[model samples]
Target: MAAPLSPIVALVRAADPDRFLATLFAPAAQREALFALTGFNHELARAREAASNPMAALIRLQWWRDAVEEARDGRPPRRHEVAEPLHAAIRAGLLDAADLLAMADAREAETAEEGIPSAGAFTAYLRGTAGGWSVAAGRALGVRGEALALLQRLGAAYGLGGVLRGVGRLAARGRCLLPADALAGAGLSMEAVIADPRAAAPLMRAMAEEGAARLAEARAEARRMLPRSAIAAALPAVLAAGDLRRAGDPLVVPGPRGLAARASVIMAGLRGRV
Candidate 1:
């Protein structure tokens, strides 16, 4: 009989269905480890949303950091859904502590009260968190060198698309993820974008276009540099590409769920393009 899904896997499926679906395409031997890593990422990314205050969020982040340190030192992780599986993945050589810790540090940027400082800063944040995770996933799957670099670019594109898709939800929580520079260039402010996203639709559309370009370039590079086995690690890019294609308005949200999204990912996976 197949082993039952772990709590971390369940949480990932619930919180980030796209990534969870992507994990299903991974080799069976690596699927659980990927789920564990992605689940840990979900927990950190959403820490602010779950906390009562900034202090609480910081505490949660610190807890994960400490957990990673313990796992690195060959200690059993604390008995929590994410920590246990994460520890196992680490022990199994499916993940490393430095990448996980860097991801955690990147997530702290999410709690910034003033929002991301600029477009460049937002991109850097995505690189450290999402791109860093992608690199770790690639390494776990035995990809290296140039392929890892391609995966980082793919991850950054995917992360940008994700941020665009989540604009509505983030704004509802009083967070403006649009770059300050981008907003200013459009004669807008963070407050203006948050209060009325329509005012910034053009700017967001442009950003989506840039992300789509990055995705295309990364896909081409992956085809040349990465083997078929490494494709699963970049599967999220398929969904991101789809969202970028459908991005029309800043306020409209990007992802199209149900059969269409699943089919897109499957097709991309079969073609080894993601």
Candidate 2:
């Protein structure tokens, strides 16, 4: 068997299986860096869940911010699995600290207990986290130009599908990310949805519509450009397509980590498309 590149793969495989599966198609030399990016993102996401309050969450986020800076400055990274590989990727010039830092900055919004305020706010979050991360991966893979932009947009669409997939889990923890306007139109509120998943039905439908539309638009645009180098970064679009189409309720779910998801990815991979 081939030797492992980094332990970050195990974490990425568990925390963000979709990205991990997608990474399999990346060049062997580039796989470690791709997982490092997703591993870093996974750790940043855990910071919110691991903290007790907003101040605590901010502190957790700050630790990552500091680690990125330390790595960029050539200083030793604070000891951590994800941080170590991320630091290496940064130093090796396979990844950019700027993009990693931007992802961390955007995650600061998770500190909000009131949930997302509007549709625009949701889009901004998607752009920063998912869009930012995919751009970082594409850059690491040497993807550039319109293909890069296409990758970023596709990432945002995947982010939306991800949010929908996690609605039940988030609500069970007293969080609701469905945009407030969409909630109002659905005659629901964040607190209500957070307390009762059923109330989110209409809002979920609206989000599903928006997510599906974005996926369609991204698919159309992708047909025009996405280069072979970007397929790994853009693979989440395949997951988003499957998830959005079969999405039921946030309180319920699809097995994106199961065989079905892998099959979808394999089919897309075989087509050399995302």
Candidate 3:
């Protein structure tokens, strides 16, 4: 039998299964670094729920920021599941500290009470978090030059699909990441979106349309330039098409995950096309 999963890997599998599956297709040696990067993202992603107040949340993020710097400086890492392996990867030169730090920096914006201010701001958030994560993973996989840049754009497109898909769940948590202008155009506030998901349908549809266009552009570009070495890094985009399609309908409940999701991932992996 295969070795049992590591704690960090298990955590990622449960929290971000899509990325977890994508990571599995990586070269065995690089999978650990990918998981460490993803696990770090998962930890940062939960900062809001991990702390009782905004200050505490910021402190938590700062703790991560310090951890990244420590990793880059060749110092002992704070003893945590994700931090340990993440620092190990950094020490091995399999990951870049700058890309990891960019992921953390973008998340600090999530602590704000107000939703995203504009479409441009929303895109920037996607660029930093998703784009940074992708390029970091791509670099770790031996991708460089224009391919690394393509990974960043593809990651942003994937993020757009994800943001649209999770709008309903986010609204339930009293958090809305929709562009303020879109919300205003729909006459909806974060509170309003939470109260009436249907009221936010128009905004969701608009976001879906945007995601489709971005994904199309990214996919065409990827076909021309994304390196095959970065297949694992880019594989997460395989699900973006289905996500964008469903995103326009907020009331549509997501079906359970089963064989189909895995099968699609497998096909994408074999084809080296995300």
The regions of model 1 sitting more than 4 angstroms off are 1-3, 253-256
TM-score of 3: 0.94
True-structure RMSD for candidate 3: 1.6
Q: What is the TM-score of each candidate against the true structure?
A: 0.94, 0.94, 0.94
State the TM-score for model 2: 0.94
lDDT pick, better of 1 and 2:
2
**C-alpha RMSD (angstroms) for model 2:** 1.7
**Runs in model 3 with CA error above 4 Å?**
251-256
Deviation from native of the Cα of residue 172 in model 1, angstroms? 1.6
What tens-digit string does per-residue lDDT give for candidate 1 at 79-128? 99888999999988889888899889988777777778787888888888
State each model's CA lDDT, in order. Answer: 0.83, 0.84, 0.83
The 10-residue segment of model 3 with minimum total lDDT is 249-258
lDDT of 2 by residue, 21-45 (tens): 8888888888899999999989888
* Superposition TM-score, candidate 1 onto the true structure: 0.94
- Cα deviation at 220, candidate 1, in Å, is 0.8
Model 3 Cα lDDT, one tens digit per residue, 1-274:
9999898899889988888989988899999999999999888888976888778989999999999899999999889989999999999999999988889888876777776788788888888877878899999999989888788888887788777777777777777788887788788777887787778887788787878888888888887787676798888777777777778766566665568767887898888886
